[model samples]
Target chain A: MVIEKIKESRFTPDVFDITTFGTAFADHMLLSWYKDGKWSEPIIKPYGKLDFTPAISVGHYGQGIFEGMKAYKGETGDVYLFRPDKNLERLNKSAERLDMPQIPEEIFMDGLKALIDLDRQWVPSTYGMSLYLRPVMFATEEAITARSSNEYLFAILTAVAPNYYNKPLSVKVADRYSRAANGGVGFAKAAGNYAGSFYPTHLAREEGYDQVIWTDDATHTFIEEAGTMNVFVRINDKLITAPTSERILDGVTRRSMIELAKAEGIDVEVRKVTVEEMHTAHKNGQLKEVFGVGTAVVVNNYVAVGYASERLELEDLPETESYGKILKKKLVDLQMGISEDPFGWRLKVEENLVEA
Target chain B: MVIEKIKESRFTPDVFDITTFGTAFADHMLLSWYKDGKWSEPIIKPYGKLDFTPAISVGHYGQGIFEGMKAYKGETGDVYLFRPDKNLERLNKSAERLDMPQIPEEIFMDGLKALIDLDRQWVPSTYGMSLYLRPVMFATEEAITARSSNEYLFAILTAVAPNYYNKPLSVKVADRYSRAANGGVGFAKAAGNYAGSFYPTHLAREEGYDQVIWTDDATHTFIEEAGTMNVFVRINDKLITAPTSERILDGVTRRSMIELAKAEGIDVEVRKVTVEEMHTAHKNGQLKEVFGVGTAVVVNNYVAVGYASERLELEDLPETESYGKILKKKLVDLQMGISEDPFGWRLKVEENLVEA
Candidate 1:
């Protein structure tokens, strides 16, 4: 690996507002290229613009995939990455599904560690603040033909993020629009999957909802996802969510939340949770909460679900009584190094490891 | 409009092979930008690289759409575009579905004519050759947030093309994978929609088939598309094709062929064509032909179909008896200005229009 360190840092932690997520970037980034059936040596360089031909395959064909992760600064000044391996694993899965080349684990983990260690000061020290890392791979071949490109670019960009302070969400249960098909790329974090949802989400926002709760494409009855995150519906004391299928993303946060809930003695059922069941539970006063889990917000509670012409308003429970709140706190505490490492989910960034 | 002419022409039409297709581009290209709430003035400049941040929204979220068109060199040394308006209409429809800003008609038409006029030498003069035009629009916002971009880049790139000499295709009837969903962006020429099909198409190719005959996502029993083109099945003498739906592309060539067939006194039926029906027709020796129509290949004949464990081999009729050949020749003749434009679909590219 070649390391080209930035001569001067451009980021000012004192003046930067972490809450404005995805706006500010760190001084350095990591890039690797896949060409001629192999990956080039990873390069660490200053964050800047890239020069590409207008006919690059990704621009016209959308053969791109990305992974979202975060790095937290512990109270003792140590930087912690929550399950970086999982991100790398999922990234490869997305690459395979999109017919792009797989990123080597060494290239992903080593490059990620070195870049974060080089820009360690960019990791926000506040309890809920972290560095949001976006690792994206896209076709870089300069061609207009609709085929899998032989050349690819893999890049990792980091931004400072603060705790989300937005209010609980009100989402519309999708009745006509669908996010994924039975055998589609929804299970992968493909760039096109997110692009396909923007218009539907915009329509929902215009209807006074924050986001959309995507349902099955074939039936539109079973819940699949909430916005870009895996959704969970709480009824009475049981937590229910759709099982991971080809049409639903297997989110790291969703998996972590389920484990955290199980360990906390909560009844978590991983099965198909239909919209009809949610409506029935709401009518019977058994539906307690609905939430979405992902890397960005960690867990976002949904206060209302709009289906057809009716809005089912969920009762907002106190923080102590909210399962979403409890699980989020537990997960956050574990991620932030404030709790014992029972699941070995956190990987520390050591200065010595960077040199090695 | 700003015109930055190239200092020297880079194309050598005498030495260039048009059959290579999309490998060589003309010297000049057109570009327009959408920022704030309006489109900037269109610019025609030397075809070159574009500078973009690695975090450009399209690279991560895939808000991209494109249109395919061709400019034919008439026998009298004039240029003509067949159904340019249809391409523009479909492009905007794709843009709307992908949540992109609509390109103005003037920008599309004026830029196309000016660019073609500027690079008139690049147009292949061979009888069966033309200039292929690719107009692509993508999100250019420098952010990783998964939302519709506020800024976009629209560009038109032209390449010399020759007649395709590919052999008749063998296709697989999709059983485990689908190209689109009931309520998805499949009908739009969205970049993501094509990216999602690369894997499934790759699998079909590995199975010794040239392309996939995508079936309905809900049932895998009804045919929707043949590869990226609109498909047609000829049972006896009547041409049958699936109606345009939320899952099938409204192909320009498909529409033209239907009209051409009707004008030739051939019966055409626009309805759902199921796989079982196709199988029964083949067993009864009534399935005369199956073909795909698109802007790229105009029309491609399918010689065989692999479904389940059986391969249904189609008889190759003589060129005179082939419906695809008959309609393709009629359409190509009208496009090349060798025949009368009965439908007024051919638009002459007047030299005066470039000055306007």
Candidate 2:
């Protein structure tokens, strides 16, 4: 691979702060081009403004997709990436849904690894601090027709940030609006899916809730997901989550937690979870914990669930031995290389790993 | 309004063709900036590229809204705009739905008229030709949080094009995927609303249809708009269409058509038209004509409607005395100043209008 490096660094590293997420960029970024049924070799260049006319298809027709993953530094000098292959697979899935060309494994994996390796100094060494990797693919063709563009631009950006959530969240059950519908692009991390969710989420925030728990678009009866994360509900000692479908995102974190719980001999139910059933469970004092799981925050505990005029409060779960805390600890330990790799989930970079 | 005019134009006049809808832009574009709770004075500059950082909110969270309108050249070298006030009003309404700042009437109207008058030659003089005006506004603030941005960029680009559709279209009734849900941004002319419909429309096109007639998300029972335009059904000499709600765009062309039909002694019914009702009407041989109305294409006749294994064909309506033909003619005549402006719909450009 022929990679181009900048002469001097333009970015100065600062302490990672969780409050300011996605605000800074590293000194360099990886960019690759696709045209005429072929992709050019990836190159790392200085992070600066890109030249794009106003008529780009991604700006008008919304044919952009992205993926979110993290790279962590272990206590000794080892660097690890948590299931990067899964994120790359999901990125291709999103591309397929948007009528875009699928990215090859060499470009998606090698480009990301090489970019991270070159900027290894940006990776934080402190505990619970990691580099957030954003891999984006968008249409670069300058036309306004309602069709897919032939030209595309793919790039990866990294930001060093701490954990997103510091406390448990309060959520409301959405009764009016929906995030995505049946047979829609909700499963993919399409850019437009995030855009339509802002207004409803803002309404929930004004109502003193941290986020909204979306239900199915057909009847608003069955639970779907939180806009940014997959949701999990605990009834009795069984963990119940909605199955991965066209209406729900196949989150990597959610999948890992499900695996960890089942491996620990816990009963995990991946079926249709209805809001009415959850209300009934809360009424009977059987619904114990509800948390949102995603790459940003592995497990965000929900302290209150509001539906209409009723509220189900589980304020004591954060301090207790809840599933969210347990799964979060296990997930972080595995990510930071503090615990044994039971399922071989961590992939070590070439330079940082010390041979046993 | 401290306007800035470009010293020279980089664009050359090109032939108007329907196939090249938004390919070429005119000489100058209108631009306005919003910051610190105020909008800057409008300006007109040479149509060129725009500088935006990768972290802009619109590219990440989708805080973008737009409006589509047109300008026509009259017989004696006069340029006219049809119902521009309504377009400006709808643009602000869309802004309100997306949680963005509303564009003041002075800036939106005055800036648009000034820009069009300065580039009057771009307005095609042929009978069925017009300059398509696209007014777009997007978030410009560089941040990653899922909230509204403090800065915004509003610009208008013009392209001379003939009618969008030359022949009547064949549309499919969406049975599985949805365009918008209840209490969503469907009515806002939002960019994301257009993005989500592309994949489903692509599927419909592969099945030999030009567009998809979106149904209500909850039941798929009631017929909504056709994703891009407002739909109308004519049964037994009466024109029936779905009422505008949060689920449908309140199109300016649709409102003009309704007024024109009422003036022509035609009964226009604005109510919920269910799929079952339309199917029964078609089966009983009462469905006469179906057309779509919007600013892009004044009135697009539907030659066939496909639902499941059934196809209701109306191929002969274009040659017959169909209401779509009559309404389209009336609209174009009124826009080009060939017919009297009964409702005062046409606004003449100040420099192009001759004193009567």
Candidate 3:
């Protein structure tokens, strides 16, 4: 295993303020190959472009999978991966759904840490900022057949994101359109899942909305997810969210919220949440809070909702002890190592832990 | 109009292959831009790969729309396009669905004729094959936001394909997945639509099958398209197919077949086709022919269907004078100018049309 502790062949780092979206390569990158039958031994190498042809499968067909996570730079300058295991689990799920090879977690983590160690300075010190890490797997086979390719490549990219947004956002209830359906690959973070939302998202933006809320495919009646976030509705005192099924993406932050809610003695219901029920709750003035949970934004607070033809103003939606705010604090505290380990969620990188 | 005609920036006459897919380029390509609020001027230029980045939304997010048409080298070597208007209409429909700017029918046809006159020899002399033309549009903006990009590129490619399949093959009735749903992007020729099918098609290949018969999202009750090819079932001497909906792609070839069936006085029913009905037909021996219709494969014949732990053998299924085969021949003859087309489907491109 020590022999596998490889070094980057090219180690040049640059500092730029070009709003950094996916072009800056770190010193090293994770590499794995799938051929014959299984994934090869994962290797970490210099983060250079892999000499891709213009005719690659990902170019013609969107045969790609990606996992987005963050490495936090604590107040003490210690770096930690917040629930990296969850990211890895989701990556494997996405790979399975896309028919791409599942990467072994050990190699995934090892390569990620190696890349992070090489580009530690790129991690920003801003309060809300973290180094956004993107691990991607894609079809490398160049055959023009409309089937799964025999070859694939996996790599990781890191970029410093100062802040996802300026403040809490307004959201809409899904009046129409769906993200994924039952027996679809919504549970996995497949690239197709993300690609399909762009059009509707654009329409939402045109309608003066930042993101969209997706409903169930069968009837468009039940509330599902919003873009990539798992939605929560606080009605009458319970933190209620739709249950994770084939249609809903099993969000990591959504799960963390459920656990924190239970731990803090707040009522949480993971069940089918209907738009009609929410409309009724709004009518009754019991719809206290409606927010979304995801890795990119943590708990994004929401202030308004769009039902059929009218907008429901949820201006006073937050509770005295708001679940979204509390969950965000608890989640960040665990990520930053201020809280005691209750769920064993955080994975402290080797250099982060002090020697006894 | 003559100035627009002499705006000659097309390809030279000889740079084409007798047998290759997407390797040959037409002399000129049509271009249109969507800016400020509407589509810009349409221009014709020498065919080339438009400049793009690795992270262009199309390359990463599968933001592409495409249409397939063919210019036929007639029996007398006269060149023509079969239903260029249909392709343009479908293209605009797809564009609207994907939020892409519509290509004006006049510009689209003008561009086609320009390319056809420039590269008429590329239209095959062979019988089973034709010049496969691909018109594609994609997001060119370098933004990573999950909304529609402000910039885009559109290009058309020419390819000569000899045979759609090495052999006729089997397709599996999708027991595990659905391709697209109601209020989904399935009706459009969205690039993401193809990406989603790669995995299930891979599984079908593993099970000694070629394609998957996608079903409705809520229940795998009704038989939809064959992922790419539109499914047409000959049941009890009637040509039955699933009605076009948001969940089903409105294929140009499929539509043509329905129209052709009417002219041929063949019983054609464009309605909901249930899996149970197909199975019962096979059992009672009323199922005649099951085939697929698309631009790549004009009529792809299927002989069997597979499901979970059970393979329903349609080998004993009856055969008919395939509406699939008849329409294919009619379509080919019309393009080839050997048969009369009352519908004005063929567009003559070569100046030598009168001499031929």
Q: Specify the highest-lDDT model's number.
A: 1
In terms of lDDT, the poorest run of 10 residues in model 1 chain B is B13-22
Candidate 1 lDDT, tens digit per residue, A263-343? 999999999999999999999999999999999878988889999889999888888999999999999899999999899
Over B210-247, each residue of candidate 2 has an lDDT whose tens digit, in order, gives: 99899887678888999778999998788999999987
Tens-digit lDDT track of model 3 for B1-356: 12132345343444343343544454445666556656566665555444443345554556667777777787787887777777888888877767667776666776567666666766776676677777777665654444566676665556555566655669999888878866677888776677778778888888999889999878888899996699998887799988899888888788888888889898999899899888888889887778898877788778787766666665433234666677778777766788888877777785631121
Ranked by DockQ from best down, the candidates are 1, 2, 3
CA error at residue B52 for candidate 1, angstroms? 1.0
Worst 10 residues of 2 chain A by lDDT: A347-356
TM-score of chain B of each: 0.97, 0.95, 0.88
DockQ scores of all models, one per candidate: 0.80, 0.51, 0.30
Worst 10 residues of 2 chain B by lDDT: B9-18
lDDT of 3 at A145: 38
Candidate 1 Cα misplacement greater than 4 A, ranges: A352-356, B15-18, B163-165, B352-356
Each prediction's TM-score against the native? 0.98, 0.94, 0.86
The parts of candidate 2 lying over 4 Å away from their true place are A11-18, A318-320, A352-356, B10-13, B318-320, B352-356
